[model samples]
Target: MDFYQADPTLENYWRGVILFGRNVASYKFALAHALYEVDKSGSDLVTLEELAVPFSRHLCQHLLHAPKQITSRGSQFLDTCVQFNNGELTQDTLTETTIRLGFNNVIDAFHNVNAGEIEKRFFLDERKTHKGIRITDNFYQLSERQQYQNLAFETNARWNLVEQAWAMGVSRNLVAIEFDEQEKLLFSHVNTRRVNITSCRDSLNGYQKGRCFYCFKPISLVPADTELADVDHFIPWKARDEVANINGVWNLVLSCQCCNRGKAGKSSHLPSRKLLQRLHIRNEYFIQSKLPLHETIVNQTGTQPAQRIDFLESNWARAKNNILFHIWEPKAEGEATF
Candidate 1:
C-alpha cells in the first residue's frame, strides 16, 4: 500500500512519522510534541534552547509514569531527564543537557518512515548553519488545520501504547491482555491487576492511515462525531476461547461504524482471504514499528514473515472448519489500504 498516495495530506505524512516511524527510544514522539508546542507560538526559526524546554518537559512528564523510555540501556539524556524529575538537576541543566544530547538523532530522523524521509518535511535540520531547526511551511499548514489538536492526542496515544508495551517487556512473558469492548481500550495484567494502556482507536488510526480497515473510508477520531472509529477484531473475538491471544493487537483493526456493525457489518464472520492478506500486511506495520505489539504478535504467531502468515492462515482454516461463518467482505468497498 502506498502510504502517501492513499491519503496524500499533510496529516498523513505527520501520522507516518508518529505511527510508523522506527522508535528504539521515544525521542521521535518527544520531538513531535515539542514541534507542536513551538508551532503554536508561530515561530518559524526555533533555537535549540527554545526547542529543549518542551522536548525535555514531555520526556520528564512521560518518565514519571513509565520509568523506561528507551529499549536499550544507558541514555545520558534520559538520565538527566530522570534526575530533573527526581529534583536532583536544575531546569537549566536539564535544558542544556537536552540541547546537547537529545537532538542527536531525532531531529534528522523525525520525518523518516521505513528508512526514508517523507515527502513532506515538517522541519529542516539547521544545526550546521544555525544551532536549531527551521520549521517548514508544511508543519505550519498542519498546525493550521482544524483537526490539528487531535493529531497531538493521537501522537500521545501511540506513544503510550509503545512505551507501555516496552515497559511491560512483552517479549519475556506471554502477556495476559484483555480488551474492553465497552471502553474500546486494551489492558495488560501486572501483579494480578489490570492497567489501562491506551485507546484502541487513537492508537490504531494512524496505522490504518486514518481509514476504515475494510472499506478504506475516513473514520472520525472525535468522540462526538457520528462516525467515530470502531475497534473490530479482525479474526472475531467471539472465538477467543478457541483461538489463542485472539484479542491481541495483531487481530485488532480500526473500522468505521458502518463496516463494523452496520446492516452489512462483519459480526462473528470470517473475513475474506484478501482481508486476511491485508491483515498480514497490517501486522507488518506493527512489526516494523517494533512496538511491544510486535513482540506480542510474534509470541502469539511466529517470528519469520512466512511463519506469521502461516499462523494467520492456520487460524482462518480452524475458524472456518468449526464455526459456521459467512465469509465477510465490505459491502461499500474502497481502495486497498494497509
Candidate 2:
C-alpha cells in the first residue's frame, strides 16, 4: 500500500514509500537522493560508476531488510561499512565492491520510478536517453520541487518502516525464516524455546505505572483484558541489526493499544527530544528497581549516572543524525492538501 494510503498525513507524503509500479509513476526517496547527490557537471548525465557509489552507500544505510544476500555476505558488508567509516578502508574501494551487491537492484528500482503510476509528467527517464545508466537533468529539477520532496520523504518513511520490521525480525534471527513451511535458517541454530519478544507486561507496565508511553493513558492488565499495555521498544528497534542491545530494558517502554498501534503505523517518527528525555527518566526508574533491568542500564551505558544520561542523549542524537529521523506531528496527518 502507498504510504499515504496507510497514513494520510503531510509528513507521510513528505516521507514516501518505496513505491514502484507499472505506469504508476510513484516516488522513491532513494532515487531522489541518488540523483541529487550525484555530480552536477555541465551535462545532465553522469556515468553509472559515478552514480553507483552514492546509490550503494544510500541503499546500504537506508536498506529496510537484509539485502537478500548469500550466507554471511550481509554481515560482511556491514563490517566493511564500519571499517570504511572508521577510515580503515577508502570510500572508493568500498563503493567498488558494494555496488556489485545492489547496483542492479538500483537500476530496476529506477525503472520502477519511471514506470510507476504517480506523476507520469514528472517521469525522470523521459528527459534523456543514454546507453549506460545515467540520471537526467529533469530528475535533478524534479527532485527540487515541493511535491517531489514530499514524495521523497514518504518513500523514505516506508523504507524506515521496512527497516524497522527487518530489525525486529533480525534481532530474533528470524530473517528469511519460514515457520509454516520450510525452515530457512538465517542466523544459526534456531532456538525454538527462546522468544525475543517475551511477556513484558509484568515488568514494563509496572515500571510505567500502567501508563501508555505516548498517550499516558491508564492501561488495563487484569480481567479487563482491554487496552492492555504493550511492551514496546522506546527507540522502535529499527536498526537493531546495526545497533546491538536495542531490545534491552533501556529501550523498552509501555504503550496502550491505541498509542501502540498509532506508533506502529508511524514509520517516520522519532519520539521528540522531550520524549527521549522522558524515556531517560523512565529507564532511570528501572535502574532504581535493582532488578535485571537495572544491570541492563548499567551495562548499556556506564556505572556513572551522568554517563548513563549522556549515553541515552547521545544515542537519541545518533538516531536523529543517522537517519535524519524526525519527531512525530500528530497534527500533520490528514488528507493530502498538495
The TM-scores, one per candidate, come to: 0.84, 0.38
Report residue 210 deviation for candidate 1 (angstroms). Answer: 0.8
Per-residue CA lDDT of candidate 2, range 274-306, in tens?
A: 677777776775455332344446767677878
Worst 10 residues of 1 by lDDT: 170-179
The models' CA-based lDDT, in order, is 0.82, 0.48
Q: Model 1 off-target regions past 4 Å?
A: 1-9, 88-93, 114-116, 144-150, 168-178, 190-195
Off by over 4 Å in 2: 1-198, 263-268, 329-338
Supply every candidate's count of residue pairs whose N, Cα or C atoms clash at under 3 angstroms. 0, 21
Per-residue error (Å), model 1, residue 188: 3.2
Q: By summed lDDT, which 10 consecutive residues of candidate 2 come out lowest?
A: 177-186
> Which is the leading candidate under TM-score?
1
